[model samples]
Target: MSKKKKPSVLIYTDGACSGNPGPGGWAALLSWNGKEKEISGGEPDTTNNRMEMRAIIEALKALTRPCRVEIRSDSALIINAFKQNWVGSWIKRGWKKSNKKPVENQDLWKEMLKAMKPHDVTWTKVKGHADDERNNHVDGLAVEASKQYQ
Candidate 1:
C-alpha cells in the first residue's frame, strides 16, 4: 500500500506601501482542502519589495506540516528569483549579485529560504491589479493594512 499524498496548498500574496520607504503592508491567502485563510500585517516603515517578500515568508511559515505548496505573486523580484534560479545563484556567489553588489534583501531571502527548506514549492507570476480575482483581493488587503500603519 502507498501513503496518500496530502492536497497541495495554494497561496496568493501581495504587498503595498504608502510611500517608497514608508509604511508598508503584506497580505497572503492560503487555500487547502476547500478551506481558506487570510492574513495581513503592516510595518511602520519599509519598502514595497520587503513587504512582497514578507508575504511569501509569512505564508510559508504558516504551514504546519511539510506539504506541497504553490505560490502566486505579483512581484517580479520574488517570482523571478525562484523561477530563474536567482536565489541559487546568489547563494553560490556568497549573496552577491553578478555585479558584485550585496543582495538587497538578503535577510528576508534567508528567512524565506529557511521557511522553504522543508516544503515543495512552485512559484507562479501574476500581473498585479490585473484580472486575477485572488491576486486583486490580496492587493486590497495589503493596501488596507498599509493604511493602518500610515
Candidate 2:
C-alpha cells in the first residue's frame, strides 16, 4: 500500500512583546492551495520567545489534517532549535541546555513537538523587519495584537 501525499502549507509567523515578561502576542499566516488565513492571539504576561513558539504551535494546531508544512520565522531561537538540532540535544539531556540549565519555554517546545507529529515540517529563517512583505505583515499583526493587552 502507498501513503497519500499530504497537502502543502506555507506559514509565516512573528511574535512581539511590549516588555520582556510583559504583554506579548503572536501571529501566523497560513497559505495553502491559493488560500490564506491569518490567526493571532496575545497573553497578558509572557516572554517574546514564548510568543514566538506559541505562533508556531497555534499554526500547526489549526491544520485540520497532516500536511507538508514550511514555517518561516525571524526568531533565531526558534529556527536554530530545529536547524541546529538544539531541541534534540536538549531532549537527550533531559530538557537541559549544555550549561546544565533547564531549557526556557520547555512547555511550548513540548507542545510544538506534539503538534508537529502529524505533519512533515520545514523551517526557514526570514530576515525580520526587512522587505519581506509576508514577514512584515505578520510582524505588524503581532505588534498590534500585543498592543491590545497594554
Candidate 3:
C-alpha cells in the first residue's frame, strides 16, 4: 500500500520583532510533492503585528497563480483578527479600528487582502517556539530575515 500526500500549498508562517517597534521579520514556506521551500523578509523598524501580517502577505505574493494555502502563525492578533472577519469589516469602514482610529497597518492589510483574493486560504494558530515543523521553519526564516535585513 502507498500513502497519499496532501496537495501542494503555501504554508505555515511566523514573524518576529526585536521590540514592539524595532527590527522585524516575516517567514513562510511553499510545499509540494514532498518538497518544501522557505522564504522571508524584514524591515529595520517595525512592529510584531506588522511582521506577522507581512509574513502571510509575502508568502501569497510569491505565488504566480492563485492556489490553496494553509497559513499558520503564532500571532493571536493576526489569527483572530482574520478569522473573526474583522479585517473585512475594517476595510468596509475605511480601515478604522473599534476605537474609530485608523488601523495600525492598513496599507499592509489591504495589500494582504488583495493578494489573498484569488486563493483558497486557511489560517491556523500555533504556539511559537513549539515543535511544529513548518511553523519553526518560518520562524527561523523570519529571525534570519531580521538579522540579515538591510
**TM-score against native, each model:** 0.97, 0.98, 0.87
Query: Model 2 clash pairs?
Result: none
Comparing candidate 1 with candidate 3, which one achieves the higher lDDT? 1
How far does residue 50 in candidate 3 sit from its true spot (Å)? Answer: 1.1
**Candidate 1 lDDT by residue in tens digits, 17-105:** 99889999999999998999999998999999999999999999999988899999999998999999999999999999999999998
lDDT, model 2, position 113: 100
Q: Candidates sorted by lDDT, descending order?
A: 2, 1, 3
Query: In model 2, where do residues sit more than 4 Å from their true spots?
Result: none
True-structure RMSD for candidate 2: 0.8
Per-residue accuracy of model 3 over 36-80 as CA lDDT, tens digit each: 878888999998889988888888888877677787788998888
Candidate 3 residue 78 C-alpha distance from true site, Å: 1.5
- lDDT of model number 3: 0.83
Q: Itemize residue pairs with steric clashes in candidate 3.
A: none
In model 1, which runs have C-alpha deviations exceeding 4 angstroms? none
lDDT of 2 by residue, 1-150 (tens): 999899999999999999999999999999999999999999999989999999999999999999999999999999999999999999999999999999998999999999999999999999999999999999999999999998
Question: For candidate 1, what is the total of clashing residue pairs?
Answer: 0
